[model samples]
Target chain A: MSSRVRKIRENAYVMNTIGIAVFIALWWLAVEARLISPLFVASPLAVVQVLFTQTASLAQNTYITLVTLVESFLVAAAIGILAGAVTGAFDVADWVISPILDLLRSVPNVAWVPLAIIWFGIGIESQIFVSAFSAFFPIFTNTYVGFKSVRPSFIRAGYNLGASDRDVFFRIRLPASLGQVFPGLKLGIQNGMAGLIAIEFLDSTSGLGFMMGEASDFFKANIVIMDMLMIGLLGFALTMTLVLAEKRFLGWQRRTS
Target chain B: MAQGNSVLEVKNLTHVYTDSRSHVETEVIDNVSLSFQEGKFVCVLGPSGCGKTTMLNIIAGFIRPTSGSVVFEGKEVKSPSPERAMVFQDYALFPWLTVSGNIQFGLMMKNTPAKVREAKVTEYLEMMGMKGFEHKYPFELSGGMKQRVGLARALAVEPKMLLLDEPFGSLDAQTRRTMQRELFRIMAQAKKTSIFVTHSIDEALFLSDRLIVMSARPTRVLIDIELKSAKPRQRSDKEYSEVYEKVDKVITAEVSKSIE
Candidate 1:
């Protein structure tokens, strides 16, 4: 059984590699045939070359974007999770705040860009605010659901076992909720990154999003393609990191139902 | 039956579940009085949806009785206390916690020192024959194993009274019988006051010293039979069968009348 699982994993990796190669080959063919203008579409090789030559500048831009993304997301996750957990723990808090959060969640994260610019101006702060706003709803909603969905029987069992209300929250509700909350956080982080990129593209003077916008304006198709790919890869890397962290933190959860 | 050495007294207990629309009220448990003595296992038997669980919940202080009092050891029961630990039908083991972790949770809640909690967890895990599976999660465990953890968790608290709501109802027949025997052994050793709720006639006869048969919703105690069986009862014995038949007839009659 173990060997079979290992073989399946290896086959999946090979298939993914082949898929990426085919996509690049098709893109290269399209560009070579001049079916599209060079100003509009760049060959994969040209994009890779651009990425290699401008490695230092790209890396610097990526670092700045990454820092801003992390700062904003962490702040939002901390506050949103804490608030959601608190509201979920207390009935009155849930009754008062859940409706307001639901209303806020309905408004698109991009819709906040103008307001964020107005509040924090066209800088890193505005971009961070936009990212934080985008990330907050998913984390809050998932956490609230997690907290509220705890089985009553568990609570009763805990109480009967001599647990205090505080004990019930910390030991039972919080742990139970994490099973739901982590997935929400993973989604929130990805959404927050996307929001950050959008804000940067619209108004920033630095970072990968800004670089993509500037390249598009100059019709530097290779640079634009390279920057876009970098953005996607970065997002993938961040998401994978979060997933790994979740697995480690929730090892006990994986064992139970 | 021995009387007047009551460890827990429930007087005129009543519980009502309110309808959301139209403000209608339906009583789950009607005015009922009962007393349980220490060092004896008491079973409350009734048909399904007969408020047997509701009565247990009232005593456990999970739900308030609309118009009565549950006095435990001469004090009025206002809320859930550590003195009354419960075992649930579904096991209700914390899915996120390991076997040892679940067993230790009650002690941790009482701010028991880490060393004492660790020892107690190890002791209970061993007692339940779950020594090596301490780190296993609930999903990895069989239904019987999960129930054992639930039992161990309740026992670890050393509560004055143990409340069991059909603790073995969800297990297989063989497992249920084994669990019943194990529970009897544990109860014999601990000698804590206990109240068990179940629909099984055989189960009630085997574990309980006194069986309180209840009528359907807005429930009331119909027959309180005192069994003379020795501890660790032999289910195949004539005396056990006779008691089972008697209790079965009483419950069947009560259920039929309630349906009518």
Candidate 2:
């Protein structure tokens, strides 16, 4: 059984490689056969060529975008988790805040972008505000659900074993909630990334999104595609990092029914 | 050792559970009165969902009785205390904690000195036959192993009594049998008062010195009998079979009534 599982895991990576290879081969063929206009869609070779030629600018913009995303996401996560824990732990707080939260969350995060820009003046603050706003709802909602969903048996055991209300909250409820919190953090980061790009299109002088906007205006399809791929790679890397962290922290959850 | 001294007493205890949405109140325990003797392994046998768990929870102080009281060592039991550590059927060992960490939890809650906590953790680990599994998480252990850790954690607190809510119910038959023997051995050594609740008459027969058979809801004590058969009693023997038949008749009647 162990050997078969190991074989399947090894084959998974191989399959992923083959799948990507097939996709790129089809794209290359399409470009080579003039199936699309180069002005609209850059060939894979052209995108790669731009990667080499604009390495310095691309790297700097990528760094800026990454920094903005991380900082704003951290802000959202800290407040969201605190708020979630509080509301989840207390019945009165849940009753008072739940409806208000529902009202605020119903407004699409994208709808906040123009107001954020107006309030914070097209600066980094505007980018942070929009990104943090977008990220907060998922983190808060999921964290609340995480805390609420803790098994009643655990709480009973905690109380029976002499845990005070405070001890049960921190030791039992908070730690148990972590398994659900990670997925929220993953969604938060993705939402923050989207918000960062949207704000960057209107505000930032330095970011992959701004670079893409600038390149597209100049009809540099290759640079535009290259920027999109860089953003995609960054998002994928961030998500993978969260996945590894979740595994590290919630290792006991593995193979759980 | 069933000493004449009582460790705890329930005085006309009754509990009614109310559904929040429906506002319907169900009287689960109806004027039940019982007492646990010092250092005796007592088991409460009843039909399934006969409020056996409710009675256990009240005794554990996890829930308040609608009327009457539970007194432990002359003090009224108002809320959960370390004095009565409970072992849940689900083996609610903190999944995040290692075996040693779980065993050490109650002691840590009491603010025991670090050295004392470490020593108690080590002692319980050895007692539960989980010495090498100290660093293993609950998920890494089998159903039986998890309950052993649960038992160890409860015992490490040095509570006045152990309240087990069908601790071995979820284990497979083979594992459950092994655990019953292990528990018998541990209780002999630890000598703490215990109140074990189970639907299985066989389990109660195999474990308890004093057996309390409860009826279906609204539940009351049907009979409280002393099993004078010696420890490690042979189930095939005439004495064991006789007691089993007596208890089986009471339980089977109750089960059918509940089904009807």
Candidate 3:
């Protein structure tokens, strides 16, 4: 609200506007000159026209993609965080899970799409499984680190203040780990979005990924470009929503970096 | 087992830590015996790594000595119990809790009724001179303020004993002196038996009813003395200087011995 801050913010917006305009102008010029094939890459104007023409179906598919992304992420976050904490707390559990986790995490979750499809068939279950699979590793690892890396002094203080082990876990351990956990959750959501798109493109009869794939198959370059932009914007908006919520809830955290 | 005579008694306490890989054992505290009288202020002063904090940790039941017993009243100390509360050097004020909540944490652990918890929190908040900042989180406060909340939290539980591990070590000199005065005031008001660990001779001299000095590891008691004091003890006064000089020389000799 201060004049100085407002002036700097306005200057930043002006610079961003110039950068975006330059990119669009170059893209438009490339299409106009036919340096890139019009049969593949669409012009910005054509993409806008396609967005307007297919507004109803585009909105419907976007909604479906958004829901699948959220539901899968919620499931992954709940299960991953709980399991991560348990494994982190007990050395025996950590040792038991370590070798399998090492093998599984190295292989990208999107590569599990074939396995998911075979197990769940062509239903929404496949999309959810694929999305949750993509999300689980990052969230689990981060949550485990959060539990493991809690300062010994904090735990000692908890015990000195008469907290039971159960109380310490619920109160200190969980909140102390929350700083790292939020970043993991954000990364997990992004990975979840990637998996949702992959499964939807390959198997789902509906959603933005299917729309983009269908458009590409028909060689509707404008529709493909519009769908791509919508997906990018959806990912951006959802991630920013999480960032804002993190700020609101974890306002007390003083980041070292 | 004379419960009325001493609030805490540690009998021939010894601790040895074995390095995991090297299989070498280092004795931290060597055959030390001491007792804390009821409602007395006790200071344990030593060099940086001289196991004074370890001694306090043992008394507070965070650690069990490898070969001896620590009795609180008549009960043997096995684990950290509500009867002994600690204030750490780093303050250790919970980051997520507001000032009021941190102070109430002990009472919450005790499962005190909501009404009493609220009243007790307000009482300690005012006692620590932290009235209006009850809702402010730890990150919002300055170092001295955070330690005040830490003190408030420790004392709120009304523990039979208080353990302070260099509680003012992080503060600037002026703030440290101010906290020392505040600590004296709080201790006088509460009348809890306190075990304070510090390296500063003046801090040990000014605050203690009994001061115990320790040598470097394997640590052993170097000097134990009781003081006669009329507090608001002026630091610049002749008697204060005399005691300070004596304590300083004793601790400095130990520090030099450690280096040699």
Q: What C-alpha lDDT do the candidate models reach, one value each? A: 0.87, 0.90, 0.89
In model 3, how well does chain A match by TM-score? 0.94
- Per-candidate DockQ versus the true complex? 0.63, 0.71, 0.65
Give the runs in model 3 whose Cα sits over 4 Å from its true position.
Answer: A254-257, B1-4, B20-24, B235-239
Indicate which candidate wins on lDDT: 2
B46-118: candidate 3 lDDT, tens digit per residue: 9999999998889888888899999887989999977899999999999999998899998898899989998
> In model 2, what are the clashing residue pairs, if there are any?
none
lDDT of 2 by residue, B151-235 (tens): 9999888898999999999999999999999999999899989999998877888888999999999899998988887887778
Tens digit per residue, CA lDDT, model 2, A1-257: 58988899999999999999999898888888889888888889999998789999999999999999999999999999999988888889999999999999988877887888678787789888989989998899889998988999999989988899999999999999998899999999999999888878766798998999999889999999999998898999999999999999998787744
Pairs that collide, model 3: none
Fnat for the candidates in order? 0.83, 0.88, 0.79
Error of 3 at B141 (Å): 1.1
The residue-level lDDT of candidate 1 at A200 comes to: 88
